[model samples]
Target: MTTPASSPSPSSSASATPPPGIPDPAAPPAVAGDRITQDRPVPLLRVCHFELVKVVSQWRTRLLLLACWIAPGLFVAAVSQQSTLPTDTLFGRWMLATGWAGPLVVLGFAGIWALPLLTSVVAGDVFAAEDRLGTWRHLLVAVRSPRRIFAAKALASLVVILLLVVGLAGSSTVGGLVAVGHRPLIGLDGHLLAPGDAAGRVLLAWLCVLAPTLALAATGLLGSVALGRSPMGLLLPALVALAMQLAQMLPLPVGVRLALPGYAFISWNGLFTGPAQVGPLLIGVVVGLVWATAATALAYALFLRRDFTNPTDGVPGRRAVTVGVLPLAALLAVMVVTVRTATGATGSGIDQEKVQRSVATAFAHLYRVQTGQLNRPDVTEAQLKATAACDKGGSTADPEGSGNDWRCVVSWHLPGVEAAGTALYQLDVTTDGRFVADGDGPKEVNGYFLVRTPTGDAPNPLWQFDGNVELLPATPKG
Candidate 1:
């Protein structure tokens, strides 16, 4: 039998014809679709848009976008009511940017249903949605390639997540500015922040705040693809986010904490402080990207390789997921160490006792007969409160390294100096081996320290009380 006429590529046109049973030489060749791109690489963005269109057109996606808008507005309003401080004040500003976007806000708003649910809803279903609806197999036939389709779907899901985050941040900021008023807020170290800095910080707080959440969404996408259940896609990511939160709170080592996305959540508190530290945040961003990418990759590999044997029950690769295990185990070890450290930290009040002894020892010299009159150490309530913060820090126990904070009330009996509430001198020594002296601090009518009554929880209007410093020691020869 004579073979069918062979077709030649356009590039091969003008070449001599082959003998019979070979492809035709003169006749225009049939179109080879694969060679269409032989001239140049197809733009990746084109593929990206193709996928984005698929995701955005879905009704659930539209509803998710709507929810992203409403969630932040309602949350900001509720916080505005409970807060006594004007949202513009130092504390209020802090609350608006970080405190609101933090885990506390997540807990209060998302409750049992975390926002990761929505992320999973989009990410998990972005691919499987097609398969679940029976459109995937048909589309695969048209695309003729599994890899390109996978990439497009993943990019589309990522774009959707980013859109959700941007929407939430924009709405929350506008809502917060309206609800709380734009005012300078305080830094984590109780320092004041300016209006410009506050605005910059609010933006950073929102942008950086959503990194881990997006990671959660990415992971949810993996679960969604594997399970093919629309609901499980949402729940799995939330559970994972919750687990990460627990890992962060377990008092793990700084290094281990650095790896956790949740640890990065509180980095926004540093915006107002003099020094900027986004170490944990950066780590979180890296780990988040890694986990998100890995999960999506593995899920795609499994889904693409497997047949439609069991739609409901996904078949995971036999290779176990040890990627998350190392960090998690390390985190758990660090947690145990941290608990031990904490328990041990409380008992060693050496620094605290040193403070008490220093005060007692220094003032004891003042009571000697040679001086004729006792010069008691003068400490204002403000000084005392500022110094004793470590002691009063939500408990009676001291923190690591004697809590790295110490203050004492230096008081002594004086013959002429009024004992009412005046301080002659003030010394402020911090536990980190530094001192804060307020020589220019307010003094009284009798040349003693003038104390200000701290307002609003003043912690007893206590300033900082430091041990006495001797200008001169009595000399026997003199």
Candidate 2:
């Protein structure tokens, strides 16, 4: 140039270079993309929506929803076709009498088996799919916030679980109503439930199950992130549920059993009872929250510290081991403390006076039902004057604690019928104060195992029954 080139205009200079911290667009694509990810902050809601949409759009998810919606109808049809009722299940015998019982029967089945597995089907695959697709690095790059990603995924899983639960409940209810006629239902206490009341209670029972289902879903989500493999993630929560269920069969302390995650699934039985057992319901709510929160927190921490720099790398470093092991160890410590506390509070785990009271009450209600079936005149509980004398394992064993050797002698009288007698019942009492009482009957009073009714043959109300003893301080009968 003749002298010095004219200084570049301020506008041109500004356009040529980004600000001091910002990477220039003209830089290499990888470097520029990295800078953009670091600088950008995606809204949490937007991420959640995206994740949810992704989850729902999957073919597997759609199939699962469809199955949940249609399977119950098929079940009802199959049950209706069968001559013999599925009396072993809680509400199985009532399917023919009332359509409402179909849902309850299905509910009992799903609570034990379907809930954990169905909840896991998607939740377990959510993160593992990313690993399978080698997209963890890409996801991290796009979001740049593991915390936000975890939240979005967890929320998405829970929402999917909710949809599944609702689908099953609604489908079963509608199927039962449409296929079977809406007749009065037999309540757990052997009393008659109006059609409307039965429907309401059935729906409420399904609703009560949501808490535990969600907790199981969270466990699946954690497994997905930790295992980072689709099949393992899918199976871990289900296996855990199976283990928890098996644990329930053990002679664990009542408090410890109640505290277990699986207990929450069956705790909804409290809803069908006359007084509505609030203790189990409250315990379920607390247990579900604790498990879900703990699992999710551990998952979040692990995800945050995960090394996705080398997308295919699987060998965990010492720090990764430390990060994973420390939280699990802490969780174990807390669990140990909780178990000790619960064990200390459990005391003898059975109260004779409470057992007697519950047995007598249950017998009175059920006997009333039996009378109606026999076409006999109605009898009042006061008139029956039901009383029960209960003992734990005979004179040799601890007679005040839980055991299968418990026995109860219940005596009651029928109004206007002269011959009334006492019946002996062998009880299998659990640590939780619930029992299955097998009756040694004066056949005339307690009746046979099955009794004929207008609808069909049904289980006798008095032959064998379930009852619960309240875990309260025993007081002498007045």
Candidate 3:
């Protein structure tokens, strides 16, 4: 050391103790710039793929899918063995006679609760499972972004719902075709549809329900995120659906009823009629998409803001409460105001021109249907030459109010009768727009009863009286 510690060689000097803040020169010499390169966020498709794999691997999911695939066949078999057709539901009267009607029966049952329940099983559990398994931390760390994770989970749930719907529709179609032959189908308009056309319409009707089903899945996902991973998350959405359905059955205002989810579920009925109306179907699609978008946004925002490090933070806080309560309160206030307005305006009066036109159209259709049932090809709308004039309590001042004392004078000519006869109709109009009429006409027409002779003995033809009729609003003729 004294011998000039021989100014250390260049190599030895470079390897000597380094400055305190500087990195070691020989330790693979630190890179010139930032030592850690930031990795790009995981792709959404990859995340969704992972979620799909997770879902398909679970025994619960597999079991539910299996049930969905088999239940329709079992239902068709059981229904085929029954002696009576279920006539309460729309299109149910023909369920046992035609393959196309079978799907309608299944759809009617599914709309009650089965579809929602099936959708919720996976949607409610997708997000909650992470928290239940104490793996949120791991998932967050692995995915590195909560938004992407939520998107992946939601997409997976939607995919699962689609699969379920397809399975149900296909299975029902196959089972129905096997159990009941693909004969001509009777439409809502009382017209006959060929077998091929009937199959197409049935398939379209089944596809129309996809919108509402996706909305339900979104609702379940929101519940899972807000309520945490639990059974409540699974049950609350179904309860909400049930409550909505009940609300639809109430005497609510038209606006409010149209806004409910239950209305969307049955919108597919429009597809089965001639001159198909797409308005309700489009509205349903809009409502479903809005609900799904709003729920997805809320879930994503809440998940991003949530702090999983603190257990107490997992519960919905003031912001969540405010987010939920404000909209509900607003909706409730609107509903209350609408219902009150509708109830108080019962005496607002009706439009004479509208009622007159409606009555005329209704009478024509009623006459045609009645005569057709008796196999009377000679009795036609043109031959009857019907004309109706309606009055409310014999005054034109207020023609459109709820009353039991409305009257219509209808004039028509019977075949081979030279003179036109006038019939007096006593009408009772309800607030819900139904018409109950009792007619007093010539003794020959008033006392006559039409007997329909059935082509087959199994289902006896129904009989009709000539002078009484119940009619719905003119807007929906069927």
Candidate 4:
């Protein structure tokens, strides 16, 4: 009995003096309902995998992936079949005619709507579908916490977006290059767009197209987590975008267009053109980051607090879609009506004979002074003066306009050359009354038919002189 008192068996000793403050090994294991275990969910690859599986399980995401392929192909085909003129500048040179080739190839084919919307469909759905499908409860048990689940979902979503973007860029670029003739690209402003430099810029421009759309996608995520319908998030961001575009297009004060997502993303023009404007470009990028980050953060928080078990369960609402679409439809309708009103002028078609006569007269006078063909007319004194007088009263595309709706300021002074023929003409002569450059080299003649000097290579001293500056209208009008 004394011996037994000296040494209680191991089990008796353990039970009598509870294990020093540590959790007793003998206690029942924790489950979801248990307080300590309930509070903490251990991070695990299994959790990440579980969320990823859920994302891929949805069929809509797969359909979007399919769209990613089909859209660019259709665009390239349309560009090839429909286009008709070279844009003239190196960047846009062939864009007017060819959809795939040259610098404008990206713009002409991918265009304004397709790529942006394709990105939106996939990006907009990432987290939104989770709420749409009523699957947050299933997600909760697999992942330790909602935040971690949201993070995995977002990362997976981004990977999907990036994959789609890559598909779009590669397919479009190839399709455009193949379908439209790939000549050197010219810009809308007619700048020489080098091909090697331009290819990279265009690829980047396609990438930058992602800029404004990310916020749309991020906002979608927020709506998914908060509203249980991803579409709610889709509405406000698109509305913000729509409102900004309207404000920008308005004949407003400075900084107006800067607010719009579409306007901010307009810097892709610079990438295609010779001189890219980085101010708008950088602003858009920064703003895009802010928009995406804020929405994502909000989604994270909402998702964290959401009662996914019951869902904000109700019939999914479509007000946001109506809100998104109606304004845009109205805008398009207004634009169509306005365009018809402005263009449906009560007038006969343009008169070519009168225009030809005027252009011929101007050419004769200017060429005589520059070439000393008429021993320098007393009125056509200096370079500027001769160009001015010759360009004045030029015939226009309009049948009724007294002066040419568009004018020309033709000159050629190669950076190093000190010659009369080496001039680059700035022809501010479009039907729209906008400026358009004509020749980038030398002018063989003035405005009408005449041949002078050529550079680089030529047959003879006469026809070789072919750096003439002529502003062709939308249609070569009167």
Candidates in descending TM-score order: 2, 3, 1, 4
lDDT of 4 by residue, 128-224 (tens): 6666666666566545476777777777666676776676677667666677645445333333355666576676777776766676667556555
Best model number under lDDT: 2
lDDT of each: 0.49, 0.74, 0.65, 0.47
Ranking by lDDT: 2, 3, 1, 4
Which wins on TM-score, candidate 1 or candidate 3?
3
**Per-residue lDDT tens digits of candidate 3, residues 1-478?**
4665556789887668675544454656435487743435688999999999998889988987887788887787568657776755566666676877777788878877778888778887888888778898777766777888988998898888788877788787777888888887765443457899999888887776776777677778877887775577777568777887777555555445445544557666656545554555555565666666666666777777778998766565566556543654454465445433433322222445545554554455556554555456656657778777878877544676546677777677789989986766666654323344555554333323233335422231111111111112224322
TM-score of each: 0.58, 0.81, 0.70, 0.57
**Per-prediction CA RMSD (Å):** 13.2, 6.3, 9.1, 13.7
Task: Output the better candidate (1/4) by TM-score.
Answer: 1
Q: Write the per-residue lDDT of candidate 2 for residues 63-128, one digit (tens) a residue.
A: 988988899878876796577878667677677767898888888889888888887787877888
Which has the higher TM-score value, candidate number 3 or candidate number 4? 3
- Runs of candidate 1 exceeding 4 Å displacement: 1-47, 74-114, 308-398, 401-478
Q: Pick the candidate with the highest TM-score.
A: 2
- Candidate 4 runs further than 4 Å off: 1-53, 81-93, 96-111, 180-183, 234-240, 309-478
Better of 2 and 3 by TM-score: 2
Scored against the true structure, residue 330 in model 3 reaches a CA lDDT of 58
